[model samples]
Target: MSQFSRLFWIEWKKLFADKTIRKVVFLVPIIYLTLFGFLYSEEKVTNIPTVVVDADQSELSRELYRGFDADETFGLIGTVPTEEEALRWIDEGEASIALMIPAGLEQNIKAGRGAEVLTVIDGSNMMISNTAVRAANTVVKTISAGATLKKLEAQGSWGDEGMALYTGIDFRYRVLYNPTFSYLSFMVFGLAGTVLQQVLFLGIALSVAQEKEQGTWQTSVATNSFFAITASKLLPYLLAGTLNMFIGFTLLLKGFGVPYAGSTVDLMVVATAFNLAVLCVGYMISYFFKDQLQSTQIAMMIAVPSFMLSGFTWPFLSMPTAVAAIGKSLPLTYFLDGVREILTKGHGLSAVGHDLLVLAFMSVVSLFVAYLIYTFQKRKTAGTQAESTIG
Candidate 1:
């Protein structure tokens, strides 16, 4: 075998030779994918416990309660006499959603003064809030429409013309992207990134650090320059990590029926840039630490927080300024949102221009950092060798 081929196979074998490394590099990612996949496997959130306070004491309020009970997303737990009690239930963890049919609600509707149903929901858990608010809004709208139509019919207005007269300025809206509104579609991008980042960081961090520990850094230095060694060390991991991310995302979309309506070319471009940035950071950490364990820890430092800060689950605006600024430094904060826009929003390259530019900048910066770190490592290694020779 040629030198390159021999070295490549050696790197490949190094992955499986250690049973602990094998499990961490492969099995941990799979475990996270399947576990999180199953957690959000249900496309829509359901059975969110809810409580209602009926101050109206009218047929309309009672009818509205029945509607909420019949809706699959909500389960009517109990009724309270006051809105304060309803709010207390939410705060006490007894309910996730609450409603108060205000006093004189039916009277106002009957007199054409307009009625409003006050909905108080715990916004702490975003998924539950989304599901509860959506379901509750549907119930309220349905009740209002049905009652309006019935009242108009009594005045000899009926059918399409009556609906048109009463329903002027209709509040119809479109989801724009994520037509199905599947949770899997919402979370798939972040999950795929989570798995990819973990393995890539773990694999690349261990690459040079393990070699240095085993006294093979000299062999690598003898054969190649610092840049060449860094590239060679990362090549096997880059290929495997890229392939693994692609297959994982493919299965996530196909198996779970998540929607993906975007250009494959766009996805490939962003994925490659993100992979490069992450691998470079890992390589920098690898050269910074001669111990594999310390290198792995440093590389993984960003892994847990990246997903949370990536604007995948949480809005970047909601975070503190310093935290948000730090999040922007990570390639994932841009990549996740960019990929999501492409897949869910049906955005073209032009639409995600800012995201692409940020990722490109990160790739360049990380590569430069890795090269500088490698240079420092080389100089330090040389100084240590000379000192030992003189002694």
Candidate 2:
């Protein structure tokens, strides 16, 4: 074989030879995909427990209470006698939504005046809060329309015209990006970044540990250029991370019907750039820590917050401005945006050009900085060893 081909084969074999590396490479993807895919698959809000406090002991109030129970979206878990008890249910997580029918609700409806129904929703969980708001609005509108129709019928003026007059504008709701609002489609993009994070962490930690265990890291630094040593350490992981991306997108997403609408080429390009940037981060972390255990701990600490702040589950726009700015600084945010655009909206390269550019810039910057740090450390170590020999 040619010299370059022989070297490549040696490096590839070295990577596969480590039993721990082999197991992690094969298993991390499966664990992440299964956990995230199954947990956040269906987006439907079904059977959320809710509490209703009905102070208005009237037919209209009772009917409204019945309406909530009748809807499949909600289950009436308790009828609290007081507002404080209902609020307690929400605080304790026993209920997601609380309906407070004010004391004069029926009297106000009978007098041709509308009474405000207080809906206290738990906003701590954004998804549940959104679902609760939608359900509450729906039930209130239904009750109002029914009351209006009955009033019109009693006056002998009930007709299509009267109904139209009572309900002036009919609402037509349209959900963008994901028309079906499938959580899997939204989550798959985030999961891609998550898988990349795990792979990068495992690759870097194992690569560093393997070098230490084999004593190759010291031998290589003694014989080769610093640049060559860094490249040898980084290149393999980059290639492995790239391959993992293809496997994840093809097998878990496309094969499983995750509804990819965006340009596949664009998604691949952005994913490649983002993975490289994060891999550099992994290398930097490993360089600072001597052992695999410390590296793993640091990786977990960094990964969890980065994932949460990426605006995958909770929108960045809705967060506090300062918190949103922090999220924007993360590389995963751009990756998440680009992937979602492609998967759900079927966006083209041109549509997500800005995000791709940001990811590319970040990758270049991170790799350059990591190379500098690695080279500087190697030079420092060599200088110290030379001084010791001269002494």
Candidate 3:
């Protein structure tokens, strides 16, 4: 064979010889396509969680409540006594939108004084926010037209004459958190979080794994306590990732003009917890897979799908059960959700208390597991060395 042809033939043989390469070349794309296909199979967001605050208990108000409840776009969980309670439902993630009917709505309509209805949409994810807004508009317009026609008939106006005289009710909708629906505001922060995850995961996935691959893992951790070994491996990556996050967000705020309504202290606390969770998970992967390339590929596999599964672009509540379960297991999901809440809603750590706790818990659990793996491997190595020495 010619020199170039001989080299090509050898390289082609080597490619199929590696199972990881074969999987990446053929199977990864299929898996990713299947995941995303199933994810968007519903095509559009539906059955958005909604709450109603019907301050007016009259039949007209009930009619309006029924209108919202009956709509397929909205799934009204329950009625709240006040708008404050409805807002609480939104904050706690019980609902994505709130419809408020003020007192005397029916009386005001009958008197021709005009009634006003308010819609409040949680705007952290603009996709869901926009869907909710459009659906809310449809429901209000339908109800208003019906009410207007009824009033016009009472006054002896009908058909085109009544339609000409008809004027719809005043419907005001407020998009909380991100009112403008700036794509940058909605998307960039989450993308940055995903980047941070990939960088940390790849960087640390080689930490102990590289030593093990080089036949030095035992010597490196053998003399050091497990705590010291784990801390030493994680501390550098943690600092680097935290600095990366701070600078990245600073640019997003100053350069992109993405608004931050939340407190800096709350942001720092959540960021720290998120960093710890990611680093610990990466450390665990390094301990689990001693091959540097295998560990790196595994990290990439996780980080690549994390952004799509994080529910940054789509609402988590709308995802399929299996997809959402996988998403909930990842640190990026909680971190991105918390970041959006802080940036758009001006919420404190107390408000996103659940997300904060989950990230913290993940960090603790992953770190403990990594330590256990390291200790087990260490004892195995020592036993092997003792046997060889006695022999």
RMSD to native for every prediction? Answer: 13.3, 13.7, 2.3
Ranking by TM-score: 3, 2, 1
Compute the lDDT for candidate 1: 0.72
Give the poorly placed runs of model 2, Cα more than 4 Å off.
1-165, 213-219
lDDT of each: 0.72, 0.70, 0.85
Which stretches in model 1 have alpha-carbon errors above 4 Å?
1-173, 387-391
- Candidate 1 local lDDT, residue 26: 88
Per-candidate TM-score against the hidden true structure? 0.58, 0.58, 0.91
Error of 1 at 103 (Å): 31
Clashing residue pairs for model 2? 261-346, 262-342, 262-346
Order by lDDT, highest first:
3, 1, 2
How much does candidate 1 score in TM-score?
Answer: 0.58
Displacement of residue 302 (Cα, Å) in model 3 is: 1.0
Residue clash pairs of candidate 3 = none
lDDT of 3 at 272: 78
Q: In candidate 1, residue 353 scores what lDDT?
A: 80
Candidate 2 lDDT trough over 10 residues, lowest sum: 167-176
What lDDT would candidate 3 get against the real structure?
0.85
